[model samples]
Target: MSKEIRNLEPTELWNNFADLNAVPRGSKKEEKVIQFMVDFGKKLNLKTVVDHVGNVIIKKPATKGMENRKTVVLQSHLDMVHQKNSDTNFNFDTEGIKMKIVDGWVKAKGTTLGADNGLGVAAIMSVLASNTIKHPAIEALFTIDEETGMTGAMGLQAGYLDGEILLNLDTEEDDEIDIGCAGGIDITAKNVYHEVHTPSNSVGFSISVKGLNGGHSGMDIHKGLGNANKIMNRLLYESQELLRISEINGGSLRNAIPRESFAIISVSSAKKDTFLKKINTTINEIKKELKTVDANLDISVTETSTPKKVMTTISQITLLNTIYAAHNGVYRMSNDMEDLVETSNNVARVIVKEEKITILCLTRSSVETSKFDLANTLKAAFELGGYQVDLSGSYPGWKPNVNSAILNVLTKTYEELFNSKADVVACHAGLECGILGTNYPDMDMISFGPTIQGAHSPDERANIKSAQKFWNYLLTILEKIPSKN
Candidate 1:
């Protein structure tokens, strides 16, 4: 555990967070963390069990006077998005997150802080280990693989949890409560073609797009952030007449707005000057358009050694056209809810090498039909370019119930404690509540947490003051959980 973070206010929460961050818990690869949670539960002598899907559940009887209150499930995903700066040297698999306190916020050094759900997991740990904090019967649900596909939640068994209420401490903003969230599907396109040697008089140049603020593809999609893959493709499209792709690679994760892209191409030597001028002009235009949202965006071109093989002109055209056609930002706004995104897509990843190509996208929507609508649209665009597209990992959305019992409880409690009403909103990101509710539909579910910024990116951080405030609110809310009805 980091000494500085352990010394933060709300030591109970921060200390546990420090310990949790010591374990590398990336999505899909969570065996170590799963064992860690199981060990933690057993150490506390709680009724611990691991489900078939590797989800950990530790049950604790209610505090002395609160045993009559309704049972509540304190839930949070154990896995977090792993992102690092291009210049930062860090191995996520073998190393723990290194944290520092800056301007009243806890941030990791050049890597994701894992506060997205790690803080939530820590909060649960505090509550489960506490002997004095008042609360009803508790079923702590620690799930895995939430950042990528929510596979852990999807595979959770029906009878494991006996809670009547589920409090998901995964929301990023401390001032708001979330009752609903969008569902999502992964869209992947793949193809293989023959490679050809570069033309006799071709000159090689490397084009790179970097310095953009890449963030969570779902939560930050509407902010008009730059998609590095899309920007690089734009330049390629403009210089198609003189350029042939030797290799192109962009983005890393399927759920983050890409931050950088690099492509090596060969251009006819006679048209080299014209290509440079065209690319510079396009970069200026792109800068102007994204000035407000992606202020740090940069695109550069430099000469490089020639490669023996390059994609044929036909393949290059098909690749450029397909990426150009796919949508990269917000697609529709909700008519029913104010300012809520109804449909969106993130051209998350693009890669071309050895005559093989793959383009991946994530399409999201709260409405079921609209989700498929946008997904199929992308499928058609890629298919038109001779790529086979697959849409999978579809998850359900959590529809809002304005009259929810827990919503009323949270509203009343917030106003009583802080003299203000908490904003009730639905988010564009996928939350595990929707999937967990499938088996336990009667469980009233809601999500809220401390303010976190730049999630899914290296700049991710958690606010110290907000963490303290959220901690107090959580304890108060637990003590007030309605008695068994």
Candidate 2:
């Protein structure tokens, strides 16, 4: 048991979270966590079922007097996004996250805290383990690969669950209840590149951008933080005439805003000093432009070993222009809802290989047509650069239900506990709710969680105070669950 986390408020919840953090559960590599959950369910003597794709469901019978209430499902993902800083030496495969308390927040050491869904999973585990709290029949669903593919939710069968109400424990804000969310699709664009011998009298230099606060591309798209890939593209485009590209690489995931990017280029030795100066000037200008959102943005140039080959000018130009022209960040705001993002694109990753240059992107929108339209726009941009484009991993948005019964119960419970109404909102980020709803069309779902910041990044943290309040609010909601007429 972790003394640091076990001492926090809502001790049961935090303790469970600590235990989960002890295992390596990165997306698509969640076998150990899945086994732990299964063993946990057995220890509690609860009815546990592991679905075809590794989604776990643990069922607990209704308390003595609440047997008449409708069955409820408390859902969260088991796998977490694995992200670490460039300077951090932590490994997600063999080690548990090192957590620390800072100013009343629980954060990891230079790595993602996994609080995006880990806290939710802990809350569910606590509830299942509790014998004191009154509640209706409960089903705790732990899905897998939510960060990378959402494969667990995708493979869930229609008749697998008996719940009429689903409480998705994945939202980040404690004061807001997410009733709907945007759908998304992943795009990969690839182009062949021919490398020729390095130009005579040229030297190789590496340019890099780092220290930007990259976050969940969908949720943080409107923050105006720098995109490392886009920044690298701008610099390359500006220096195309004087440089020959040897390699370009940025970002690793298709759903995270890039925090760092690097490119290797060959430049004439005579212009080395001028080239470095120009890049430094560009860095300063960019920093000034994004100072409000990204205070530590860093761009620097350093000499590197001369490469034997560089990209053809035509290929370099096409690649840079394609990246420069591709849309990034918020593309449109919702007309129906105030302060809602309706459509957006994230140039999530870029890679240069000996044979090909590939770019990966994710586009999201609550409206179906807008999502496809944005995908078409990206396809066109890459096609014009002679790249083949493919899109997959598409999921639908969850439309809001104003007449949701569970929503009424939750709202009433929240008001009774805190004397303030919870904000009902729609999220721009993709949620498993959107995909799960399709199989269980009649279920009423609402998403909420403790106050978490910097999700999907190394700076991710959960507020200790909010975690307790969120846990109490959830217990009250479950205890007061109303019976279906």
Candidate 3:
């Protein structure tokens, strides 16, 4: 807790967030947050229910004279993405998020801020606790495991919610209303190779790529930020003449762009200085090439402990080729929407474990056929390189229904409250609405939120002014819902 973190509106949001953060709620591990919401509902004496998948639904009766209005569901995910800086030593399983305020923005000290949906969660809590705001029948639906997958929403029963109109408070931009989102799939390639004990005359060294700005692969795909894994592959390909590879590893989450990566290699003791000089020269050249985008990018090498065994020559070549051939960055932009990315792939994580190497890739596309095509392409590449591929955790995309009654009402409300038209569009990121819509076919939905930057990454932050505007807009929309009967 720093001195600068006190007295901000996001501080109030963080206080509640800290309570939620203290409990481990990573993807499938959402029982604790579910209980917290259940207990909060009990304290308020509201009608509360928890599904088998730990999704919590809390209902608040309509205000006097507004009981006739249709029930509205305020939806947000209960889980936050688990990511941290390489140097920060906090464990996500037990430690609370270390948050602080800088100027007027709220951010984490060295981790993701979780404001992607935490602010929405807190705003709903604030609304539920307030006795002054006037509103129609409301249901706060907190679904679990929205980050890793949409398990909670996917498991939702048809009659689980009584609301026909759903307001998903999950989009990152404030003034933009997101009506659709891209679907995603996870692809993994595993290769097991024999290791050989090499002579002790070889020196062990580590090569690293650092200082690149990595963000949400979906939102920042077009930003031209260098992927550390890709950068490392390029370095290895360039320096293979001077070094022998041993082990390589980087990244953790599939949704976030990797900012840094490192590789362990072996070289003859006599060639150490030349290897270092060559790597430095390559780093300088890459920096110059990416000067406009990754100005701070750096590549460095250092001496390290020798490995007991190294990959065989055949295995090493296969691994290097596979990594070099892996697809990355934006694959295509939407032909229908100018400047919008329709398909993309991220080679998120690479690890060497127990004589085996695993590469995890995440692919997203607004178009269903494109997503499958990208997945097939990756699968074929891995098979050609003689590796076993596994595909799992696929989620469907949510398509926009511009003709819905809820969108009509939201558009009118925005005009009435702010005297400006809301920017309505679709996104390439995943949202829970797609799964919820599948559960309840007739449900009408729209998503909006305060401005949040760098979501799912360490640079995450929320704007205070945008939050105030979001709260005001929500209050206006609540008071204007049409009657059900």
Clash number for every model?
Answer: 0, 0, 0
Candidate 3 whole-model C-alpha lDDT, 0 to 1: 0.84
lDDT of 3 by residue, 137-185 (tens): 8999999888876788888888878898999999888778888998999
lDDT (0 to 1) per candidate = 0.93, 0.92, 0.84
Put down candidate 1 lDDT per residue, 400-469, tens digits, no spaces: 9898998889989999999998999999999999999999999999999999999999989999999999
TM-score of each: 0.99, 0.99, 0.95
Task: Give candidate 1's whole-model lDDT.
Answer: 0.93
Ranking by TM-score: 1, 2, 3
Those runs of model 2 whose alpha carbons end farther than 4 Å from true positions after fitting are: none
Residue 148, candidate 1: C-alpha displacement in angstroms: 0.9
RMSD of 2: 1.0
List of clashing residue pairs for candidate 2: none
Alpha-carbon deviation at 143 in model 2, angstroms: 0.7
CA lDDT of 404 in candidate 3?
A: 85
